[model samples]
Target: GGIPQVIARSYLAWWLGSPAWSPDGSRIAYGVYLEGSPDGDTVQIWTVNPDGTHPRLLVNLGECRAACAEGLAWSPDGSMLAFHSIRGVPAGTRAIYTVRADGSGLRRINRDGLQPSWSPDGSRLAFVRFPTPGGIPGEITHGELLTMASDGSDAIPVLEDVALSPNGLAWNPVG
Candidate 1:
């Protein structure tokens, strides 16, 4: 049973989104709203030592026009972080991206997907889509779930006609 407790809230910066712990448990990385956030033109990633001494800003998504970061994951090896964003590059598009845990070499991994979950081995990710380029919302249509490799190759349709939201899905950590 592994559950994390938010002992200290991210307060130095007001805009705090998803938070993921590094594999080594030395630091935590999360998305933060610099000044505008959610409605402003900027959102970014930041990290702080567990003792809360050395806080640092990792990646800024404001330039991409994304407003907020909602989901985040840490690579098993602690070398990288995978995160879901509503800002960056194309702007306003839901996507997945990764960057060094220390805030270096940020890159976009997926351009159009949502609800990113990393594989146990950290070599692949699972996500959901809106079936038909924006499938019927409200559970009115049947669209299967999808999966893809970490490099954005071999995007295979693993499920069929399940549901589509382009932003939501149901998955249990354990089955």
Candidate 2:
């Protein structure tokens, strides 16, 4: 591998995380944290060219009561993006969402999910669902791994009642 190079940088004091390259490898999608905004620290999705040009905002998850959007995943066809957002206060409800790459058709797929990963064929999405009552309380010791149709239907737990890492989810391309 060649020496690392910085292709993009956040303006002002915003922070960046959750970088996901499009399937075509032409654009990079990531979450930007607008720190100290009047509405609090909110996270929005943005895309930039591989060479760091034509930066565009794809999704603005307005006013996150707590932690907002993260764990962005691009569809196999590079037409859509999936991510998880935690909203509300004290309780901090979590949900999975998807939007077109052009910044439209934003939809919440799952009411309770995190760390979304699209299937290699782009036909399904897998995510983590922590148990209630203790809802992501400290280290996750009990949760379920679920997969659903691309449009968020027929969700079924592939694994349950296990200690799951909130950030661990992926699909084997060969599968």
Candidate 3:
């Protein structure tokens, strides 16, 4: 389609989320949800080449269905993708994740995170991690912005109170 829109849930409808294009603008990583029923949604990772060819499903959430997943963004070098997943909180509990560009070597790189923004230099990525405490899930405990190396090292808290409500996270790259 010229402009994609929500194809509403049916038995096999796939509701696609925002599309994240690669740094070189050669491809896109996006979210897709296969409706289990009219009321059930299963989130997963999907990708399509820039030319809209070779569209493929990268990761299935069935293995991690207890978690909700979305918000896919690519690294500056187009070598990897950074996205978020939630561990079942109705609205969701998020964490950041990464995977190789070819769709191999998937990894859950962080806990309690969202909105992964990779630095232009490809050295680090910034994300928002929520503050969940006392095993209580209803409180709006506030989320803080964070940055970490691509290899999952040297995680640093950079900004706070920057996350938007409802979606719950955001971060901008440092120039």
Candidate 4:
């Protein structure tokens, strides 16, 4: 093989997002796009091993109008994963959700947040939130730095006017 050797494959027809590795480095998780059966184009979360084994479904977010299961981050303890999805919400809206690695306890934590990053202690999640409204397809909107508990409660905006469009987020390891 080449320098970048091939790894695992999801075996799904289409994959729509990046793959995230568990904190313990045991598994990789990603989102698969299911298109045009009875459900139209939907994105679902899936997991696989580093060596391309034991692929399985993690979170089944039915019918993400735009995108789903993006910016996945494993909790420090490797218990859950936080990601953004357009599932179960109005079109053009993205939300943060967490699901257990074992494919249980799927819950939406925030309504309009994306690219969730877990705090060092795994007690809270920091994500980018689109606070201001109205924009064209490529136009930039105001994004805020927000944090919430692991269970998706008590959301507080930490910083206002972070950037016009924030893609990913991370917490300071020493902070």
RMSD of each: 4.9, 2.4, 5.1, 2.8
Q: How would you order the candidates by lDDT, starting with the best?
A: 2, 4, 3, 1
Model 1 poorest ten-residue lDDT run: 131-140
Clashing pairs in 2: none
lDDT of 2 by residue, 15-107 (tens): 677889998899999887787867677778899997788889898887664446688899999999998888854557888899999999999
| Between candidates 2 and 4, the TM-score winner | 2
Q: Which should have the higher TM-score, number 1 or number 4?
A: 4
TM-score, each model?
Answer: 0.71, 0.88, 0.72, 0.85
The reply for model 2, stretches above 4 Å from the true place, is 36-41, 133-138
Cα deviation in Å at residue 160, candidate 1? 3.0
**lDDT for each candidate structure:** 0.65, 0.82, 0.67, 0.76
- Per-residue lDDT over 1-175 for candidate 1, one digit per residue giving the tens place of the 0 to 100 score: 5666453454445656666778789888777665544545467777878766677877766644333576677766888887766554444566777787767888787876666666667677777665355432233455556777877677877776774554444345452
| Local accuracy of candidate 3 as per-residue lDDT tens digits, 117-173 | 778777887776667542122334466767899877899987676433324233444
Task: List candidate 3 stretches off by more than 4 Å.
Answer: 1-11, 37-41, 63-67, 88-91, 132-141, 161-174
TM-score top scorer: 2
